[model samples]
Target chain A: MAAIRPGALDPARPLAAVPPGDPGDPGLAESVARCLNDFFTARRGAADPTDPRFDGEVVARLERFTLLGGKRIRPTFAWWGWRAGGGPGSGPGAAAALRAVSALELIQSCALIQDDVMDGSPTRRGQPALHREYAEAHRSGSLRGSPRRYGESVAVLAGDLALAWADDMLDDALDGTDRRARVRAPWRAMRTEMIAGQFLDLHAQAQADVSEPTALRVARLKTAAYSVERPLEFGAALAGAGSGAVAALRSYGSDVGTAYQLRDDLLGVYGDPAATGKPIGDDIREGKPTLLLAIGLRRARERGDPAAADTLRGAVGDPGLTDADVRAVGALLDDLAARSAVEAHMRALLDSGLAHLAGAPFAATARDALTALAGHAVARLR
Target chain B: MAAIRPGALDPARPLAAVPPGDPGDPGLAESVARCLNDFFTARRGAADPTDPRFDGEVVARLERFTLLGGKRIRPTFAWWGWRAGGGPGSGPGAAAALRAVSALELIQSCALIQDDVMDGSPTRRGQPALHREYAEAHRSGSLRGSPRRYGESVAVLAGDLALAWADDMLDDALDGTDRRARVRAPWRAMRTEMIAGQFLDLHAQAQADVSEPTALRVARLKTAAYSVERPLEFGAALAGAGSGAVAALRSYGSDVGTAYQLRDDLLGVYGDPAATGKPIGDDIREGKPTLLLAIGLRRARERGDPAAADTLRGAVGDPGLTDADVRAVGALLDDLAARSAVEAHMRALLDSGLAHLAGAPFAATARDALTALAGHAVARLR
Candidate 1:
């Protein structure tokens, strides 16, 4: 039941380090997509004949939504983490690593579907949010009940299904791997942290907590551990890596993940809608307590700029905010130096993460690819 | 890695067969409660200090709601299933069986919480629904955003946490057991089936499908499998039971489970709020696609009584139906003999289930205990 095959860890045979393409995975993305396609195809076919509509309504939509679009960033990090931990570049072991890490995307699917219902977002990845789509179908199909409620209810079940299926996928992936127990620890932690992070995000909006500390904590739990650290740690565990390498990967993951979320904060306000696939100024409209907003608000009050502070307070959480209003607020933030301050912070975090990677005892090739990933994570437009 | 200890399966040394007191488990209840208490206590204490609010708002409430009350029906069935499969009466293996079965309660918690939000239920188990509670707090505290939206959002997250924690609890229970993979198959199927069943229920309501077949299908998936069959099968799997015994238990579970749902439908329309802990006629008001309503409608139509059919249809799914309207519908169902028909069907189901038990090679004590459970399941007022 050994996870690694003999000579798999030989220094002379470094793991593959495929370069990412244009802010996303090129080579690994297909493998991940194909893996998911096969899995869902089987699931779809297995839909009970007693309820044919279940397949059309739920299973089909889930398959389409999952295969629709994602950056595949989480799986990429996990794959590289496995490679860095001395897993062979090819063979059943490597294939299992790919399948195991692909489960992260299903987790991502659950988060996004649930988040949309919670936020009442209109769109995701340029398509109507899953709930919104279901709601629209209800309206058009002349279905009974409140269309909005029906949509949200269906979406919740859909998210729950994805979460359950993700666990099943992980179990399938670990079928014969001796590292199942090792991978379970991080996987379990990641799921709880994801839910806890979401709760905090909701609370921050409700209580209007705009503190930088709260913002960072949310980013660390919601994004850092979930998006980077745990995925890397999970992959390393899958390879049975020594504690030293696992710790280093975790350190690097935390820094990079935080930076990545910070970058997302910037994108939420400034990134093009076409690229980010989100409405402009959604964070402001939803009153999300991101680090950038906290800094902006703090700087305004500290500088005794009551007018700027008042403008921010008035615009945030205002669902009726117009695009023109958003542009004006963006200008105000820039004038207050909040945008530049966050950018500087993001750079510092990324630099620190790379430094961790530099000192880690990872295979030579994984180190190079990891550097490229850190760069793309922070610098990407979307 | 053997699941059973040597000599643990001796027929002469039968497992404990504690009689259920009143409507629920009296003997096993305390053990399940203590196991949950210790687990949640550890979880609450482990809450990160950075977000104290999360602990109070999310984790603590989850702990309270889980520990507050439940009939512990699923766990009781699982325990009996284990005994029927020849698991030891008491020891570490027995304790693990209890711990593993208790996870069903958490899953129930998740199902109940999310269901309230979906159904817009104001109360549950004689208290405000979790979402309603959160909504009241938002209004009283004057929190940001729509109180309704906030409440639903929070409830969704709470349910997600419960589901995730339930899995972790099961994992902990299986840590030293050799039956992890065997237990996993049923566990995985049950999770998907639960969600899928829920979706079908929603769909039936939305589509206005009032057929008897659809009603039975929904009951089979939602209640039969999730509440009874899976618990029995899951427990049997934990004991490493052979296929013949497992099949018999499943047959017994399905019959009893469907009878249980039929009883629930009757109670929803006719039972006292004092005992049922739900408002009278709530199901008709909410337009739930229950077997009783479907049968009543079918019988009315088949008897060439359009007036009766119209009255039944008009009364059902009417949100503003008065208490008198419900009473009229109940009288109409009785006059059509629909009530007697359902009662007969339930008796037949219970008899069939008991017959399965008689045919199976289960221990004598377990057989008697399971028969009592079946009677309680279908005959109780609640």
Candidate 2:
């Protein structure tokens, strides 16, 4: 109940002291879902429908959208991070830990919804994006104002609600003073970094600052830090993990997380559309300044292929860009040795990150899970 | 430092036991300003400019917009509420209360910025709206992407940061466990209601649900609850006020807060543009579904003035509305008896609220302060 001392936490015997999660990964995911469901049910019970403070439609949409399908990657990472930091590994203890970590999913939902709105993206995960969904509803209902504006407005509130609700859930999950105090820094840092990263991304797009350094900074803050590094750190903090284990997790998270973004950028540009659920080379049309684009541009300029470099410039960020133009851009990237260069970089990051995991100060199975996750995350770098 | 006993807090004696605030209202405002300044300065020092996480332009704009002029109404209410519940009235005690309560202002900034964006208002308090300011910056710089989109994106992040930073300030301001626990519920509810209120506002515009009940509901949630009731409750809670005092504050807050909205509605339609910093009758052009509008429509209908009703309809929600049209609409509201009806209603609410304060369980001077604030808040009704 008091403030935790770093030396008092048993970071050495983490997962080794307990059995594997009884229901394991799938069961952990189910527990997280159940926790979320119970939380929302309690909220629904407490709120009066006629209060105007909570509109039925808004609540329903938020509930449905958040609970719907997506890989629960962040929550899984957080759970593993806790296990890596000497948390009890099974039974109700495991359930409570899962509940706390599940909060990350809600924050992720907020991030994705806001990101989609900011990008003017119409779809996400093969479905209408949150803003688009609300906009369509407005149109269908024959609402008075501009459907787009109304949709965007409500989506903003919905995204904000997701964030506030996540905080509420985390408050409910943390039972003691030590846990709350320890988690506060990482929790604050995670939200701050994500929001700042969003601004940086927008700034990059506005300024067209496409250096590899700029690209990696965006990847680190927006993707790596927000998605991977912070979640692990937060979970470790919640478990009152020692500095050594925390450092190892951060090291592994930073490298593997950056690799994930590099691989994602590659997929956005050249991976199969059916497999990735996105149109190949769509990033070129949107003119998103990913590392893949940075690598291509660098190689083209370095090799003194002026024609290829010019073509790449013309293709990327062109409003009137066509599928044929994307195909041409893809060919140019392949010819310029740009694609292989990024692939090599991703490989190096994953290798380095996995080596850290091997020497990480955690019990056996959790370390193995993180190593496997790193490989799976960057497996798309074909 | 133990859990507060409500009776031990002495909600009845309130401000009478303490000397006149060593720094009174003006000094309290100054302290709030200083606290905010210190917080932001620390944040600036801690952030590395070289790190992409802190965009200099974004940080600077957030600081400027937050520090710029406003009445600081919410913070004042919170401070007085604390005093009314027997918090120390002056010295370091006053300073601590002000620091914690001033967080409401940052939240206010977030609300105003987001409201301006949602309403697509070009200006706020005689300056460019946050989104418009960012858009202007983009255009002046001849940024690569859509200026409007970039502006909106950055504004969203800025507003979010304000909310998060406010939490950080509040976290620092709380010195003990009991105060933290006391503040959590009201804090959570305040944010929840404000966000919900925003949605209700947007919904009203979208649905064109001009029923008086709908309008009243919007006022209650968006204005009465968010801007008034919750802030008072939050402060009293922080001071460990008994439930009796809490209930009385809520009763007084509800009535006075609704009157405040009524006055605001009146100003929107017919008040001096120079004083209000808004164009006269601008709400009519936008067809904002205020209770004033609802009353006008109902009066026109009840009086069998179909032509007047039709004229009113044609006047409101017109994008190309001219100055002459606003004058004509003003004349129509007068003829329909709608303007006086709203004025009479405002008076009744204020009178009823003042009566509640007279019986409220607080010190006589605290009671006097509430009475004066009520008058000041509704002074524009004329």
Candidate 3:
């Protein structure tokens, strides 16, 4: 295993960039942000203004959700990966790479909209979720009938539009001869894994007979693929990295992706509402069938607590569960060692991922950026 | 305009390669059908076996509703366009083209699934629409919970999955060096236009002030871009067509696509329920402000019939409107010469589209195929 050391800075800081907010980094981030804004603007321009289907509200919602705030981790990964693979950061190729990276943001938007709908979450990025907003808009007497249905329909459409736009942006970015084929494989894989992962996730939740092993498999497929490995591989592929480099990045990515998901599971149950932008214990209310839940179930059974099992089943989908109940459940999870098991898994994953990256043929600066990214991926818990 | 001639076969048939119920055409048709089936199967394989999210009923519903029973015009356009652009029909390139064409079918599926949700249509392809099926499944006590919501959610996820798969399938098919760039442009255009057009359609419906001219523009952008012109251009692009050829195909495609959409509008309002697999007067019930509606509104206003205008608006969204009332509205539409105007526009479009094709440097066979396609584009009305 790689001997990884914690960075000097607190890993829990949300943004990847430091507090001084590197003047140089922001410029690149701004460029990417500008590219994203321009891309959406041009997209809206392509629509017929007279069509009632082209809801400005829909576009506005997407823009606000997508453009507002998130760590531009994927784009940064792409940039760092390019530099690592001996590609320069300032040329026509670089611009194309950045444009391709912009696609990550669009993909993220697509995922979030669908995720919001799937999770039935009421808010996103400190605002009402798209579906909730639409539903509320219906209540305001602007639209006629079935706000819930309208919200869902519009959200679905917006998501579909974003997904299509992502492809278009990627195609436009890779229009050049040099990077076209090289970018295709990773681009395709990133999309496939996302969809496959989502399928696994939805499947795991819906199945009554889900086991602990099955839940872990679901997490690996759903969260791991798009979250880390694919993003890293996508960046590496853009740099024309060979199979060996790509494979190493994949290993690193998979480990980090798994760790990231495991941490997300932890946060889902125990994280503060203010930090997570979700209600405390929302996952438990939704019966998320998460890794923590699986572990807790196992532990509860091992302790011969039939009442605990019943309590869990009742609490899983109970929207009325209170903060006190949430705390109690959190304590039970901790007592059951579910939290520690996940943390241990995350640690092992981090070690394996960093170890793979240590021997990768990356420049020192690139290596540091990646290592920083890995630290950031797991920094929330620490 | 190109010369019009009478022949043993109806010129109105969209493609001359195969007639309705001909066995020889079934080979290619069957290949397409099988390809589509296999595509869905391969995709479904990725789903978890135990998850009710992959419920047999939903899969069966999707297979029954989305997978089967399309004219496969887009794929045919794609395949024929490639052949016309100098790609052989039997080589690896041709096979790849076929796969790409199959991807179009999947895209169409994505579009239709969402379109049903948008329009709230209760049936598709002679069966209960996906959402309706889910609703029914819930009502029948087979699946518990909000079936309507379940249907919509599943459909949205299915559409998302299908859209992602379309990209995957396209990538798999276009795994070649020579035609990658050539194929990418039109492929990207098709995707962008469809989404943009959908937005325009939605936007147009919300604003009561949408004019006839603007409605036509929306039709051109949304329908024409995806249906005829873009599909042909996509296929031609893969075969390395020059600018002139591409431009000619675009012009032809634009006209044909518009005419096709116009015909569909007519069918939506007046076609037999059995034939269209839509309830009679669906367009009226949904208040779809289609081109036909625009023409009818214009004519109604021109005739100084304020009462007719009021009646039109009042009757549009009335789900409980009687069959007689629907027929009466249909008659009023015809009395205002809306149908005639649409037919005139269709004829003009067909003429203009064929004229554009006439000047292109296409093989005689391909040109003939296009001519047949144009004839078919307007055939149903007569």
Highest TM-score model number: 1
The Cα error of candidate 3 at residue A211, in Å, is: 4.1
DockQ of each candidate, alpha-carbon based: 0.57, 0.51, 0.31
- For model 1 chain B, where is the 10-residue window of minimal lDDT? B8-17
TM match of model 3 to true structure: 0.86
- The lDDT leader among the candidates is 1
Query: How displaced is residue B111 in candidate 2, in Å?
Result: 1.0
Query: How does model 1 fare in lDDT?
Result: 0.82
Candidate 1, B295-348: lDDT as tens digits? 999998889999999998887678899888888888888899888888889998
When sorted by TM-score, best at the front, the candidate numbers are 1, 2, 3
Which lDDT tens digits does candidate 2 get at residues B1-382? Answer: 1122333223122222222333365555566678788888877664444253464766667777877746666777787788778777776666677889988888887788888888788888789989999999899998888998888878887888777777777877885545777888788777778888888877777777767888788888888888778888888988899998888888888888888888888877777777777777767776677777788899988989899889888876776788778878877887788888888888888888778776678986567667766665456454
Q: How does model 3 score on DockQ?
A: 0.31
| Candidate 2 structure quality by residue, lDDT tens digits, A115-188 | 88888888887789889988998999998878998888888888887787787788778754447778887887
Question: How much is the lDDT of residue A261 in candidate 1?
Answer: 91
Residues B110-131 of candidate 3 have per-residue lDDT tens digits of 8888788777877787777776
- Give the whole-model CA lDDT for all candidates, comma-separated: 0.82, 0.75, 0.71
Candidate 1, A331-369: lDDT as tens digits: 888899898998888889888998898778887767877
